[model samples]
Target: MASDPVTLNEFLTERLGAGGVVDDPNDLLRYITDWAGDHRGKPLLVARPRTTEEVAEIVAHCHCHGIPMVAQGGHTGLVGGAQPDAERPELVISLERLSRIREIDPLNFTISVDAGCVLQSVKDAAMEHDCDFPLSLGAQGSCQIGGNVSTNAGGLNVLRHGMMRQLVLGLEVVLPDGRVWNAMHALHKDNRGYDIKQLFIGAEGTLGIVTGAVLKLTPRAQATRTALVAVPDVAAALALYGQARRSCCDLLSAFELIPRACLELAFEAAPDLPDPFDTVYPVYVLLEVAASGSVDLDAMIEHLFEHGTTAGMVLDGVLAGSDAQAERLWQIRERMVEGQQLRGEHLRTDIALPISSLGDFFHTASRAMAARSPETMVIAYGHIGDGNLHFNLLPPADLDLAAKKTLLHDLEAALFSLVDDYHGSISAEHGIGRVKQTSFLNGLDATERELFEGIKALFDPDELMAAGRILPRTR
Candidate 1:
């Protein structure tokens, strides 16, 4: 192999085709920035590898050259985890070309796929086999399976199906030094010591580049009932959730909390978005109950509405009569994110608290925000079933850019403080990328920090893979 710097592109093109090594700056634009446009970097080139062997070769070459590398999936990361570092020139290895459904075992209830396979494609394939991949998210159309596994993403179905961590049965990873670690098994019960695949599941591509995965699948739901219910407050929402848990048990798939501000914003962003209720409410719960077999899902949903209304927890609600209606109802929750984006810049935080302490945290956090900046809009909404809240803060319209910046900083300080007081996680689903590194490090204890550093050293001894992503950059 030639080690000359001038032949770097030649070497890459030799391992992969000429189309694989993207050295042109025009084509590099897409790989340099994240979906959020929050972070951007300048990389020497982008390597699109089709096979795990090609990925290993690229990583190994970069490792030998002392050049850091960033492994990117669909580039849908919120925390800039997929973005390369701007200060240092890094090699970005994109897995988009490796999109392929390797195998689907109906008997094993597993789907083996290349990390670059689009999430929605995997879901569609599962449905074809009379199964379901329950990890549904807003970016399902574009986000890749590898990125989902790397972040251990939590979506609407987390309450029933668990996060990506639970769904992933095995992984195939390219280690820092270009060695491949293949643990792509579909077994459910493995009592082997130290589940090696677990290390790379949520490591944010820091430990290694995820090449493929074997994900667990669930039986397809025959009947799904969707409803948008108005609640008096967060407490009422929690009460409704308790009733839902009692009535449906594991059959309840989704229970999202939607505050009035968030809904109003969504309406403003998308005027075509229909309003389900006649009157406005302080809070809302978008709940879905789904199950397979001959179970009467409608009866279960009706019973929940009855109990909720009887207990004065439900103010007003609308239930979908058809699959199309259910999809339309779901659009309200999905479009809420777009609404926030239309409202301009806002500080987004993914925090989780104990399910029981959610109401108290909301009230306490609201009061604290009021004290800090009464004009700041607190558009908090999230997967209430799993206790994760996207506590977003939108600055006042009157504030200038500088003022908005300060307000966001202050708002983050106040909100994260409240999260700490409640002993909640700083990041609920989004991994600690470059954006939250300081906060993540601040919240870490000395012992945990030492352990994290040790693990990073154990895998990425030279820190050439995804430097400054999850763990701080040593060099």
Candidate 2:
């Protein structure tokens, strides 16, 4: 397979005709810039396929032409994983048009959908059948299931429902050589051979393009109890989390840590959002418990608070009295992201540590950053239940954006080193996209790097399936 620009264009026009080709530079703009505006690139062409067959055809043509392929979903990825790198002139295969909900099995509690289907759409379809697809995320409204599966996305509900890997029963992927592997078995037990579908789960599209998926659904929760509690510090937050997990057991759906800074920013951005506490505490926990049937959730939460307060774990608390109050409380969490986005230059790190080490991680990270640069603000917050913290570092308001770049490398190093020390993952939910590839590779040993290279060669020998991703070049 070799690339000849003129020859390939002619072949594309003859094969795909006018159906799914987008070569216009202006039209290709959306595919170039990443969702976070951190990375930008120019994709030689944008392929918008309407079906699995069309996607296969595109991949086959790209394979034969030695034209590297980049699979893009809703382009809502925070990392630059969806966007092509500046080094390569790759073809962007957007799965937006391949969006089609194939089937919904209420009895089996499974839903089959095309990879291009919006995550929220799939969740809505599951709800239509009286089931729940619990992979909830900030970008669910636009991000595709294919992207979610590719990155093995871990959303806010990872504490309860787990990641995309748990929800996904099977996947339909097109290999680098353009062969479709339809492993769409919706059965509970199938140890027939190698669990090959997993190879593409978190490969970051380095292995192949996921075209379709059969996802397992859960029984819909009929009742929920939501509470916003204040903790004196991270240690108290962890104590509250332990109590909630023990009391609620499997019913514990979410336990989120919200720093005072995050809440302050939210209040500044959205004044309509009601403050849960009269006096802002240093730390806050957004906790929720859900069950499939009606139960006295209020009493359970109230009872927990009664004892928790006595133990000095809960400094202050506010239970959502009504549905409107519940939604308003959730709004505070949702607005956290918006507030960060609107604020000055910041670096958002998605790292997960051992649940017990979360407080230490935050304390150490804040101290390290402040020692290195006191003007830097560390707005630490995330799912304490799952130990995934979006430990965001905000630059001084007076610091120039360009000047902040010079300080990023050192700050990121200190933070990642701290994470590694805690036996935590540098990337908890967000996959290691191009932006993190160098650091990701540097963290691996020769043995691990060798295995990564071997697998990359096996699935993508030509180095054409999103090469230089996860594994850097010069391997």
Candidate 3:
């Protein structure tokens, strides 16, 4: 029941005027596809709304016409959640023009911003006000604040700070039926009612469109230290992490576990990068400690490494002497991704387990990967402090695209089957977008599925908002 071609033209002309609607095919192409160039779709039209009223108007019009709509922000998501449907007549509503930082309260320790404000810009704004925004990610330069909230993103600082969920104090959302919900309380204590803002935080636009948010800010980190460590195995890495926590006390900020194979790939990708240690160990850890007080953080970090070496937990290590050296060490970690992209046709899994189960799960998952196929090489690296691992499988040199495609099912099943035994989630930071929807649904129990369905129906009865991305739609 989408509006007819003539009706659509008339609606745009009357409601949005000239600059609001984009009709050029080339411009349309940018909104249709994802940033990764993997998934592409065709949108009936792309609407750029400059204000909240404009968004509500578009949503209400689409609802009246019985047309589906997909809300997009930044479009840097790895999962195909932002991509609209090509077969159906769906409207793609881009919030890019709504970029604005409305308020930054220093005393309240909050910053309220429009959905389209880029993540790095928010951080810069907070820093300018002599505060800090702790939610940091590699895509912080381009990813929007709305997308970060939608995914409830977890990054390197989650050990000290929390995920995007914990940072958001309140949200201003436009519901599926075009009714607005303004919950921008920006208060630390609001216990009178249910936490309604929680629903829209990680819903990924299935229920409503997040137009604005109030995020908590923190005092800027004063003293900082980083180190590249070598551990015997996952068990040693866990032990070292515990020691690091006790040594650094409240200052331990990041503890990442990196496999030896992943390091080799980084070296291969970046020849200028020098190895931190003379002896190559099976595992390495990139650990950091930051303090807001006047603590000698570098000395404390060095002491932690020395004690680790004495306890036989660390084989070798190097503490970053200067800020430039620390940045270089991080560059190696960032370049590991490019190293991965150079190797084609990889199966990447973003997963989490209980902190206690990490060691056992890591060993078991490695054995499982080996049993499934010797051709697939395992490269594991992630924020071990929070029990999340990016366990990636590299395809064999001889396997072609068609053959790799055939093994995709077994590969995914073999990995996810471990989740059942370890009481872990199939996805940790990444939401169940179009790419993971089928597997996600299959892994859920009857009660969980029913609950999720009820929530979806209650908010979006017609399921017109980003239909088939997180949940399937009925004809």
Candidate 4:
């Protein structure tokens, strides 16, 4: 007299009609994993809800049945946040059907969109009204707005526009117990107690499912200037960054640092990408300035170049004369990730420290990594202006599979230890999804760890939403 497994197909078909549930193994296979291809989890059924009411019904049904559920958006998360554990019979609630731009309030400088709306679509919708959605990334075409909100994603424009948290004005979420909290409103200042929208922004869907959002918009940039400047060293890079900050002020949209090794890899990976400088420098910076009003951006860039040249802060520079040229310059910066991948197995670390401590952090981490594994290839680059660095360590070319794993483990431990020494974060833009769950526990102390658990409990008492993600299980 064993109980039968829940007939998820029948359940979904009955509740949402045959169109809502997809039981085909081929279709389900794609939703079972994440962008990183690290986690492979299967679900009893993949449920696609078209409306908020449908989502509410599905969540409520799963809650009543004590069935574990995972909410998935574009599945572009780097930390395996959207992956489900195949060992368990889980239900994947796909937001693909919920894709829609509900409203655009240009007067309020906000756009209301369903959680399933792709990031690029939102940006396009904003542009339709002559407004701009400041939050953007390389995955703009694939990643969804709900996923961005869930991770509080930061991108190239963070120096000017801030993170996803800043752009989100309000949210509509479905609680675990089946109640819908419709807080979707475009309000600049609301003294409402608690500001519940903040709870779900970076919560990674652990608390509740984000159904929709009211996002802030900005005026489209009328003028933009991009430059690829070569610095003498890390110190000079920091100096030039300070000068740019002072001169350009708020117009300074991006200031990214790229190591020579990263550029080499980019050139290797992308055969068409041209080198900006005539000579290969130790470090190169991709800087951009955007203004809403009429301004001589080229003159401002020329002034910065002249100053840098005089001070020896910059050895050489190139300014993009056209939009195509600007995109070409940006391609070198954006392809850093793809370029690093060509090197083979590597342990990537996205850690952030104070801007003042970046040089020391890099020196110490590089030394520590070299001492541990002299042959390891280190590819380091990132948003130097905001102090976030991507310190990626590649396995030695001569090492075997087993040896490489050991090296990777040691490298991660040493790098994370150095990050801790600087009182920096282990994961910066990427949320603490499954990939960093262990790191999260290891990084936090007793008090901080307890507080994290308390917050999770406060939001999701049943621990049903995206379980085994940000928090570690108590043994």
Best by TM-score: 1
- TM-score-better candidate, 2 vs 3: 2
Worst 10 residues of 4 by lDDT: 1-10
Error (Å) of candidate 2 at residue 401 is: 2.1
lDDT of 1 by residue, 253-329 (tens): 99999998888887887789888888989999999988888888878888888889999999888999898989888
Q: Per-residue alpha-carbon lDDT of model 4 for 1-475, expressed as tens digits?
A: 1112346667788888888887888888889876656579977678899999999998888777777788899988888888776566568888988999999998889999999999999999998998899886888899999999999999888888889989999899998877899999899899978888998988888888899999999988888899999998888998999999998856999999998988888788788998877798999899999988988888889999999999999999988999999999888877768777666667877888999999888888899989988889888888888888989888878888789878898789878888999999988898888777877888779999888889888766777778888896432
Q: What TM-score would candidate 3 get against the native? A: 0.96
List ranges where model 3 is wrong by over 4 Å: 1-6
Residue-pair clashes per candidate: 0, 0, 0, 0
User: Candidate 1: global Cα-lDDT?
Assistant: 0.89
lDDT for each candidate structure: 0.89, 0.86, 0.86, 0.86
The stretch of ten residues in a row with the least summed lDDT in candidate 2 is: 1-10
Question: What does candidate 3's lDDT look like per residue over 69-119, in tens digits?
Answer: 989998888788887886875788888888999999989999999998999
Clashing residue pairs for model 1: none
Quote the lDDT for 199 in model 4. Answer: 82
Cα error of candidate 2 at position 141, Å: 0.5
Model 1 RMSD, rounded to 1 decimal: 1.4
Local accuracy of candidate 2 as per-residue lDDT tens digits, 109-195: 999999999999998998888788999887889999999999999887888999988888988998988899998889867888888
lDDT score, candidate 3: 0.86
For model 2, name the residue pairs that clash: none
